[model samples]
Each structure stands twice: as C-alpha cells, then as structure tokens.
Target: MTGPTVSSPHEVTDLAAVTLLVHDRTRRVLGAFLGREQTVAGAARETGLDLRVVHRDVQALRRAGLLRVTREQARAGRPVKMYRAHADDLFVDARHLPQQAGEGQAAALDPLFHHAVAREFRRALSDFSPGWGLRVYATPDAPGFAVLEGPRSARRLSPLDEWQGPPARMLSGTPTAHLTTAQVTEVQRDLILLMRKVAEFSAANAGAGQPVLLRLGLAPLTEDELRNLHR
Candidate 1:
C-alpha cells in the first residue's frame, strides 16, 4: 500500500510559529507525524515519550499550524484523532525576527543540537570493545585522548570515567579568551573559510567516509561570566 501523501516544505514566517517549532518536544512530535498519519498514542510509542506529553505536544503543534487532524480512526472507547505534519519539512524564515526573539530562539534550539550529538556519541559507545580509544582534537593547538583498556578502566579516567567508544575522531572545545574586535572579526573569517573547506572535502569524497555531524559556534562571554572566571 502507498504511504500517506505529504506536502512539500512549508515556509514559516511568523515569529510565534518559529518559536513553537524550535521547541524540542514540539519538533519531536512533529517529526513523529511527518510522512505519515499517527494518533497521539502512536506518536508516544514511536518517540518513547509519555502519552500525556505526546498529547500536549500534539495540541501545541496543531495550534501552531504545523500539524493537522487528517482523519478519525474507530477505536474501542472513542474515535482516535489521527494527526499528520502540515508539510514534509519546515523552512523557517527568521530573517526579520526581532533581536530579542532571535536570541530566544537560538537559546531554545541550542540544547536540541547538543542532545543530538550526545545521543550519537552514546550510540557509538554502545558498540565499544576492549582496547578501543577515543581521540579528540578540540583545536589545532590542543588535543586530548581517552584510552580504554576494558570496562574496568572506567575508574581511572576521572571526568571521562563513563566514556567508552571505538576508535573515533571528535572535536569539542570551549575556549575563552580576551580579544579585540578586529581580532574577533578575523577569527570569524577564518572559521568561515574552514567551514567551506570542510564542505568541499566532503563533496569531493562523498562515499568514502561515514556520516558525521559538525557544529561550530562563537560568542563572547557575558560580563558576569567573565568575572566569575577570576574568582
């Protein structure tokens, strides 16, 4: 049988809609409905979320116009409402969002990205074997390694005590420094060049390497945060 028909990408321009779509749970609920119609219970089961939580997220998504009730399914107690995503994908246009709202949206979306990276790392660790090692080159200047002899080696690793994974390449770092505005601008330009080079390399060697997710971010520290660093 054919699957449910999904419309093309939906363009979301409303600030409220953008805010709602960036929320982690709302995104997950909408994902569960994309390309298929599903009841709240089905979404809950697929996402492994609580039934009440899924229902609440669905209602919020519906109100945001990101989801729609497609049909009703006959069930034992009552007719179950089947929901589908309004489109197969969402294209958010926040170019005109107010400064404060844009910042709020970024803050709301940051954790979701972090969670994705953490989840991938955990999954990689699940297949870990003895004598495996993890090497992280946070930056060209600083490198770190966590070698695992076996499961029992966890106790000697301190902060990385719980880390166990096959040989892998990873980059992560949060380096704070004081810099002039011009220096920061130069660094930003270099970062852009680095991103372009990475993209070009990936395109040139498309099928040779496994998929990897890369996230890059830069921001100045708040005055309060900087002050705390000295204490």
Candidate 2:
C-alpha cells in the first residue's frame, strides 16, 4: 500500500508538536523514519534505543503529525505497521507560544544542547591532532574568529614515546564585559547575524565536509547573578 504524501520542510507551529520536537528521543525516532519507512522495531535498532521507548516516541510523533503510517505488512498474528516522517525537514516556530510555554521549550532544550556540545568536545579531543590555531580578526563591519589548520610539516614530528603529553590543547575562556543597554543590543544583533551566516555556510557545504558543531550563547546577568560569581 502507498503511504501518505510526504513533503519537504514541514512548518511546525502547533505547541504540542513543538514540545515533542524539542525532545531528543522524539527527534531520533522521527529521524529514523525520514526518507524511509520503518517499523517500531527497526527504528529501535537504528537508534539503539529501547524497543518500548521507540514505540512510545513513535506514537507521540504520529499524534504530533510528524509521522504517518505508510503501510501494514501481514504477519502471523497481526499486521506490522510501517511508519515514515511527514517531511524530510522540520521548521519549528515557537514564537507564538505563551511565555510559560516558551520557558518550557527552553528548559526542554537546555540539556540536549549542552549534551551535544559536550559530546562534540569529547569527540574532538579523542581525535585530537596537533597543528591548529585560532585566528581572531576584526573588520570595520564585524569581529570574528577562525580555526586555522597548520601545515603538515609543522605538525607533530616527534615520536609518540618522545612526547611529554598530547600536544593539542583546548582553547576556552569566560570573560564578562559590562556594557550599556545600546551596546548590549548591538552585540546581540551582531551575534544573530553571525549565526545566520554560519547557518548559510553549513547549508552550502552540507554533505561535503566532516561534521562540526558550532554553538553560540549570549545572556545578560542580573545584579544578584553577577555578584554570585565572586562567591
């Protein structure tokens, strides 16, 4: 039997749908079905999730209109249902949600975001190789940073046993700057524009390069929060 019609770039505006999509497990189940049909058992295998968890996620996704049963296969006792995503891409819009709902979305996403960042950092360190540097530059329009790969000849040439430790080191620092309201707004605008450009670049280079994670965060601290930093 033919499945329901699938589309590209599904626009998700329902609050229920948005809530489901924010979850990592639901996304994993939906991803397993995207561009292909799969049974609950099959999705569990592909995602390495428990069968019961996959079943629950699939049901939730179907109810959210993010998934559809494509067909049913006749088996010995019952028919096994096949499922597929409603669209290859999903664009979730939560701007219309109430303040409480928006906060809930953020709370749901916070752990997943941090987990992804941490996973990528661990992966990078595991595959760490020497010979890279960060280049910071500022043009009249904006300031930016780039990770520059050093030449192979300049890379670690010593034998493993001769080295004292891993030559690569992580670069990170947290510096707080006090600014006027207008200055804060300007910085936020610049960060938004930078994120947009990064998104465009990722789309342009999709499927052509190694996977990389880029995360940006900007937040203003309250007086109490700022004071707590010292204690």
Candidate 3:
C-alpha cells in the first residue's frame, strides 16, 4: 500500500523565493531531495541534470532556506555537503497576500496562517482525483486536518453528530459576516486559541485513534462581492 504523503509547512516569505521554487530546475532539485538526504552530486544524478546546473539550483534553494545541510563527508580532497528538503510542502497564499510588500501588521500575523490556508486549498484540489476518499472535518475545533474515508469505510464510520453527540448539519451554519479590521483580528485570536486547545488534545491522544487527514484554513475573503459587502 502507498504511504500517506506527509507535508511540512514552509511559507513563501517573499516574491523572489516564490519565483525560485516555481522555476523548473529548482523545483526538480527540491523534489529529488524530498524524504532523503543527498549530496549535490547525487542530486544531479537523480535529476539527470548537469552537475553545474544542479549545484546552482541547490545553492538557490539553500539560500532561500528550503534545503537543510544534513551533514558533510570528505571525499577526494574536499568535504561534500549533504542536503535535504527543508519541507515536504510549500504553502504560498498568492490570493490573500498583500498586493504590495511592507513590514507591518500583516507580517506580524501568525507566520503559519497562510501556510494553513494553502493546505486547505491543496486538499480541495486533491479531492478531484479518483480513488481519493471523501473529505470531512472531524470537528470545527480541529482545523489542521480532515478525515478521508473511502465510500465503504465512510459507511462503517459514524457521522459527526453520532461520534460527537451533537446535532450537525451537512451545509454551512451561517452566511459569511462583514467585519471591521479590528473584529477580524479578534476573531483570528480566538481561532488561534481554539486550535491550540485541539492540538494539545491531539498530542495527548496521539496513537489512541485512527489517523485522519486534515487541512486547516482561515482567511478573509477578497472576492468582489465580499469586498462590496464589507461595511
């Protein structure tokens, strides 16, 4: 059986870093290092790219903090640097990031905020593939991952209301609200606290239950309709 794909959150902090990761050669170089450590020469061999090109691409990834220097081995007359991908996942929020760069409040928001949002977007896209299981939020309090069960598995599993002993709806609870900037900030603060509580509970019961897939997301809608609705 295939293993569950693991993803570690890595944020795109700037436009330049984003550009570098999306570049064809750099992306391949990063892919080659995922889940394993490799020397520059090994990466070049795996990618079937020129040694010089692989060296350059790896350097770029290293500069962007996307590659970790795993160790060093002396070969010939010099030490060879072994590197690995810093994260298995890259989360970029092109849709919600500020149009212009600045060092201010937006930068001060939880560094992982956009990363979580991007994970949710990724889950939505992955659901389009066949053989993928149905995605469902286990609980509103736990936002980081969703549970995925095949149709047969889903049938065996109890619904959320049955599992949690609460009335649940298949549809959303309420329409999106228009809030002031301060209100939005306050709401985010509450969400962070809730997520922390759920995380603590999850950690304490780490292996007590079956594994579930989840993607946490919280973002202000920027659609024209939403913007027009803002008070």
Candidate 4:
C-alpha cells in the first residue's frame, strides 16, 4: 500500500519516490543488501537477480536516497562500486492506521526506538567476534524481548551454552494468559530491575570475565503470529 498523499508538495513528492522503492523487485534488492554492503554483482548473486536488473534498481534506489555507495573494489577491469541499503528501515504514514487515541504516539515512537536499537546492534556486530548470534524472545502472554549475547561472532550457528561457559541468562513467563494486567506489569518491572542490577554487576566486574554483548527488548506481539502459533 502507498503512504498518504499529504498537503505539502515536498511530502507528496517524497512519498511518491519512496513508493517506487517499495515495488516488488526493488524491495527484493533492498532486502538482499539491507544490513550489509555489496557490489552490484554481489547483490545480484545474493538475490539471484540479473546483474543488469540489479544495476538499474540500485541506481534508482540511489537516486531515491535509499541506497548509498559504501565503498568500491579495485577489480581487474573497472573499480567495482559497492552499494548498501542506507535506510535501515522505512516508515510510511498510513491514514487508515488504527485511529485509537495514543496509537499515533506509539506509532511515532516505535521507529525511533527500533532504529536506535538497530544502530546499536549494528555497531556491536561490527566490533564483536563472528560467533555471536541473534536470540529472539516471544510469547502469547505478554510483549516479548530480544537479547543479543556475545563473545564469538553472531554469524556463527553454535548454540549459546556450547561456545563459552554459561553466561547469566534467564527466561520466564509462559505462552498462556493466566496473569492479570497488574501481574504482567509486576513481572515486567521485575525484569527491568533485574537487568539494572546486572548492569551494575557488569560494570563492577567488567573485563574480569568473558566479554559479551548484552541487550534486551520488550515489544508487542503481532496478533496474526499469535493466531498462527495456536494452529
């Protein structure tokens, strides 16, 4: 779906440009290179798209201000230009979005929080070893959190316990809704408190133990996914 066409001429113009990038093929190209830098040939290889097609889309995305030249490779013939999706994510204003009061506030805040997290996560990945891996948390009971842990490259497929000694990890709550809203709030508050304590402990014990990139997030679950889970 396209974003809302608004009053400002510039906003309308910008929306049109962004809508083009949301086309199927262009979207595929963007997804293929979203988190990593790649040459046109490399992107084509990754997406199984024709090189000429990738070349055209990449230029279009560049002009639309979605992709950027990350760097170039000195190939035998021409300097191979490397491109990457600079837009970590996109936000489109939908007029039909649920109009419940405060939904707009939450909608606006969501991207700011998420993109900030993405920026930090990318920074951590770039600096950490390759064995680290992404861990996702979800439940039907409440909003879930995702944590990134490390010592090795996240790109590796090893299980958490196998690599280094067991780091301080905790998981709780169930996929069923047995608790009241107050109970859920209490659990969330407790989790945050525990994490704060851990931060204090971590700061005091920094460098004395195995180094790891620790993170946590709590976000709403998609109703559609929860429905699928029941099946």
Tens digits of lDDT, candidate 4, 1-231? 999975432222365456655466888888877778888888889889999998988888888877889888897998988888766656545552234535666777767655665665556556654434656544455556445444443343356443432232322223444466787788789879978897888899976875444344444456786687689
Report the Cα lDDT for residue 127, model 3.
55
Report lDDT (CA) for all predictions.
0.74, 0.72, 0.68, 0.64
Candidate 2 per-residue lDDT, tens place, 123-155, comes to 664665642234233335534432333323334
Candidate 3 residue pairs that clash = 145-214, 145-215, 146-213, 146-214
User: Using Cα atoms with residue i matched to residue i, what is each candidate's TM-score against the true structure?
Assistant: 0.44, 0.46, 0.39, 0.35
The superposed Cα distance between candidate 3 and the true structure at residue 160, in angstroms, equals: 49
Candidate numbers, best TM-score first, in rank order:
2, 1, 3, 4
Model 3 clashes, total count: 4
Deviation in Å, model 2, residue 4 alpha carbon: 24
Q: CA shift at 218, candidate 1, in angstroms?
A: 7.4
List the candidate 3 regions with Cα displacement exceeding 4 Å.
1-8, 96-231
Better of 2 and 3 by TM-score: 2
| Predicted model with the maximum TM-score | 2
Candidate 4: list runs displaced more than 4 Å.
1-13, 95-231
Q: Rank the candidates by lDDT, best first.
A: 1, 2, 3, 4
